[model samples]
Target: MTATGGAAEAGQGPDQDPIRRSYDTVAQEYADRIGDELAGKPLDRALLTALLEQLTDPRAPVADLGCGPGHVTGWLADHGARAVGIDLSPAMVELARRDHPSAEFREGDLRGLPAVDGEFGGAVALYSLIHLPPAEHRAVLTEVARTLRPGAPLLLAFHRGSEARHLTDWWGHQVDVTFHFLDPDAVTADLTAAGFTLRAHLDRAPYPHEAETDRSYLLAVRS
Candidate 1:
């Protein structure tokens, strides 16, 4: 959870550049190849169900931040939550909109979303924050706190590890991005500092048939 590499210059941070550029570059290929991934992930499906369970009503607006190809958003809709997908990559947004016509998708940074204060009852970030350096995580959580109504829940999924990873290429395409593996204690501390009441934290080794690396999920409520 320690800061690594370099920090952004004053008045700017991680969301402004690298993440957007890299994801936008990979959006199409990612969508075409991995859009239906949730169909194969049972644990993720159960966690998402639990995410909606915290909401008092199924119709409450629940956002999928860094929604990528929108499969999770669509799943939320299918299961009950009024879901809208948001991402920092325009290309990803476009693919999400096209691929998952049942749900809505928008492109925007997590540091400053397009939603008004207290506009949503729930939200989820599925493996989204891994691209963010820890220096930028709290501010993003602050924004999440602002966007969610009091007592609303948010679920986050990320890789679990001590070191950071740099990817120079993905899906045979040249791209620049950094993915951070996080410690649960550090993530909980950031969520608590951002005005969230932590509800649960869980981690497990990756599914045998899925991608490598351990995974973590945190469920928190806006205070």
Candidate 2:
């Protein structure tokens, strides 16, 4: 599945946003180091497999919202789903373009997607939502719902917690970004309120050598 978003709902949106710039500062390094990261994570791969199976149109592009470096977007392609990866960072889009020329990457924001209503067949947000403040979750999900076909599946992976963490540096690069950990119930409620049929909510302990935080995977269908 793919996830999608536009740079902003209005004009005050994602372009050059701190999160975008933060990722931009490390875009090439991130792409070289962790872009193809799903290869080592079994659960993530399994979830994507399930997502791929649920897509209604095999040839249609899936939206990858908050698609950093377009790795997950390419992963979707590896599994046979056409994908369009969207990010707020132009540098990330450029790295993704360089790495996976076969896929499409655009600079966008999750609050508003540029696509026509129901433009996608499926969507995925792999840890992308973690960057947004909780208050924006529903608005983003609402935009998600608007851009997807009815009953289209959405797969989400996120860190689980009760607060947001701000990082001043990452991978040895100076940066400013906030990561939000969320409760599954709250996110599920947000999805329901945004016109989606909650499908599955799964959480797992972090594996060795992975980020030292619990993770949650949610599967929902557009209503």
Best-performing candidate as measured by lDDT: 2
Estimate the overall C-alpha local distance difference test score of candidate 1: 0.75
User: Tell me, what's the RMSD of every candidate?
Assistant: 4.5, 3.3
- State model 2's lDDT: 0.77
lDDT of 1 by residue, 1-223 (tens): 0011110000125545666666667777777667777777888888888888889556679998878777788889888678988877667778778877888876666777878998898988877677667877888789889999889999888888888878788778787777778888888999999999999888888776666988888999998
Number of colliding residue pairs in each model: 0, 11
- Model 2 spans with C-alpha error above 4 angstroms: 1-16
The CA lDDT at 61 in model 2 is 78
C-alpha positional error of residue 119 in candidate 2 after TM-score superposition, expressed in Å: 0.9
Q: What is the TM-score of each candidate against the true structure?
A: 0.90, 0.92
Task: Give the Cα error of residue 65 in candidate 2, in Å.
Answer: 0.8
lDDT of 1 at 131: 67
Error of 2 at 205 (Å): 1.1
